[model samples]
Target: MESIAIFVDVQNVYYTTRQAFGRRFDYNALWAKLSQSYRIDIARAYAISSTDPKQRQFHHILRGIGFNVQLKPFIQRLDGSAKGDWDVGLALDVYETANSVDRIVLISGDGDFQVLVERIQQRFNTKVTVAGVRSLTANNLIQAADDYIEIDSDLLIGQ
Candidate 1:
C-alpha cells in the first residue's frame, strides 16, 4: 500500500463548497475512501480560527475523523480585507515529509500549488493527487497532478 499524506485547505473548501453546492464536504466519507486505497501517514487540515461555535465543532469533528487540525488566527486588515492562507505552511510540511511518503493528496482549488506539485512529483518521484471542487479547481493544478479526484456529489454531504 502506498503511504499517503493528506493536506486540506479548510477555508478554501468551506467557501467553495458553500458557493458551489450550499453544503459541506463530507470529510468522513472522504477519509473512508482515501484510507481504503492508501496507508494514510498524516492528514492535516489548515483552518482559520473563528468564533463561530459551529465551525469550532466542525473542526473537532475533523479531529475525531483522524485529521490534525492546524489553526491560524483570522486576520482583518484596516482596509477590511481579510488575510489567512496556508499555502506556504502546507508546502513546507509536504516538503518536510516528502521523502517518507509515496503519495501526496492535496485538497484545494487554489492554483498557487501547481509549482509545488510539480516539484514533489519530479524530485521525490511521488504520485501527487489533487482533490477539489471541479468548477473551482485550477486547470493548471489539475494538469500538474499525476491524478485528479473531483470533489463531486459523492464527496459532499447530503448527496
Candidate 2:
C-alpha cells in the first residue's frame, strides 16, 4: 500500500468542530484510523503557540500521537490582527512532498485550500482528502478533495 501524509490545520479543525458539532475531538483515534488505512509517512499538525498552558499540553499530546507538530508562534499584530503562519508553511510542505507521497490528507474547514488541492492534483496526481466537520465545510474545498472525512462523534470518539 502507498503511504499517506496527513496535513492538519489545527485551530481550523478545532474551532469548526466545536462550533458545528459541540463535541470534543479525539485526535489519537482519528490519527490511528488514518495510520491503519495507509503506510502514513507524514502526519503534520500545525498550530500556533499560545501562553495558555493547556494549549501547550495539547501540542505535546499531538507530538506523542506520532504527528510532526509544527509550532509557529502566534503573532498578534499591533493593528489588532492575529496572523496564522501555518498556511504558507503547509503549502510549502505540500509542494515539496506531494510528489514523494502517494496520498495527502488535509484537515481543515478553510475554503482557501481549494486552489492548493487543485494544483496538487493537476501537477502530481496525488490523491487528496479533506477531513473536517461537515457543517462548516466549504463546498469548493469539499469538491476539490478526492475524499472527505467528517470528523464527528463517531470518528472522534471511535464509535
What TM-score goes with each of the models? 0.96, 0.93
Q: Report residue 15 deviation for candidate 2 (angstroms).
A: 0.6
Once model 1 is optimally superposed onto the true structure by TM-score, how far is the C-alpha of residue 7 displaced, in angstroms? 0.3
Model 2 pairs whose backbones collide: none
Number of the top TM-score candidate: 1
Q: What C-alpha lDDT do the candidate models reach, one value each?
A: 0.92, 0.86
Writing each residue's lDDT as its tens digit, candidate 2 over 78-114 gives: 9999896688898889878899999999998789989
Superposed Cα deviation of residue 115, candidate 1 (Å): 0.2
Best prediction by lDDT: 1
Residue 147, candidate 2: how far off, in angstroms? 0.9
